[model samples]
Target: MIAVPASAAGDGRPAEERGAAGRPSLWNIANVLTMMRLLLVPVFVLLMFADGGYDPAWRSLAWAAFAIAMITDLFDGELARRRDIVTDFGKIADPIADKAIMGAALLSLSLLGDLPWWVTVVILARELGITALRFWVLRHGVIPASRGGKLKTLTQGIAVGMYILVLTGPLATMRWWLMAAAVVLTVGTGLDYIRQAVVLRRAGLSAAEAERDRER
Candidate 1:
């Protein structure tokens, strides 16, 4: 009698099954949520500018849309990581969705004279620069989110929400303060991510050299 090897037995399964086990599905719940966030961007912009930022009803609807979109950002990431359904599509689409929503809100506010253009320029520069930096360092390693990065997101969300709601009096003053805090946090975290990229590149080089030494 002849004995078949276990490896050969496993290889006898269909290619589709093997691929499914090794790679994440693109049409999972997490990716759907990310796509939904992207879809919400235009809706948010339309609602925000429908009445020239004057009518309370339109402003309220815009705020609701923005809030829902932000909530999805939180859950989509959590679900992806928890369910082990992370994918390259999710990695690329997630940040684009986030920046799109925030950018729409900031640009609308500036155009309506609610926010200064300078604020929009600074925040956007940081976001786009960091995004480019991430792609540049892909050969090295991923930079995980730090506590400061999370704080910056939170503060920026709150500031944008307040701005969309178009609050007046004391609430208006509070929004400026929140935005100031967000700006500080955003700049600090941007610098930190650049530093982390340098460290990760050096570590990757060291590991590669050590592997060569072992092979020799």
Candidate 2:
């Protein structure tokens, strides 16, 4: 009954399930880091708003915290992979953590008038949509992360970083360009994800139909 947010990384496990190891999977090291990342989202948001949205030091600190949290996004997944400890729970938790961070940051920025609501909506929607599509594909087996997807993530991460830093320094004008890049990548990767999702869905339907035919 865990009504987890759509943006949350959902390795498809409920809150209480364990993998083959008989350990509380929610406590798995990798997922624990992901949860920590999720928890940090509000701290960043709070700091952003508490400073009246313009305190340079607070802004810098917020961005630094954000960047550090983002690093965990990379490391946790890699560690899971390298250790062959990937679990369904990890799969779900990782993405949820990522989206929570992105959505929270984007919303905070938009709240302070640094970003427009329309733009934030597009970005947030794509993030959530692609994630849901990913799980749909996952049900069919591993659909490896695409190069374009990685690029999208990279650009968005850096773009958000720049926008935050812009608030801290005098590079305010570049905010528009950073926003533009995030938009472009969001659309591009969203399309790519949709394409893959379609292919998988069609393939799955065909397999299901074929199995039905076998008994006839």
- Root-mean-square deviation of each candidate, in angstroms? 5.3, 9.0
TM-score versus the correct structure, for each prediction = 0.84, 0.82
Worst 10 residues of 2 by lDDT: 15-24
Q: In model 1, which residue pairs have backbone atoms overlapping below 3 Å?
A: none
Clashes of 1: 0
lDDT of each residue in 174-201, candidate 1, tens digit only: 9999999988998999999999988988
Top candidate on TM-score is: 1
Which number leads on lDDT? 1
The segments of candidate 2 whose C-alpha lies over 4 angstroms from its true place after superposition are 1-26, 167-170
Query: On residues 1-216, what C-alpha lDDT tens digit does candidate 2 reach at each position?
Result: 778653254444444444544333556667778888988898988877765877877888889879988989989888766645577788887888899888888998888887789988999999888777777777665556788778778878877877776443445666677778779888987897788788888888899899999989
Every candidate's lDDT: 0.87, 0.78
**Model 1: lDDT of residue 112:** 85
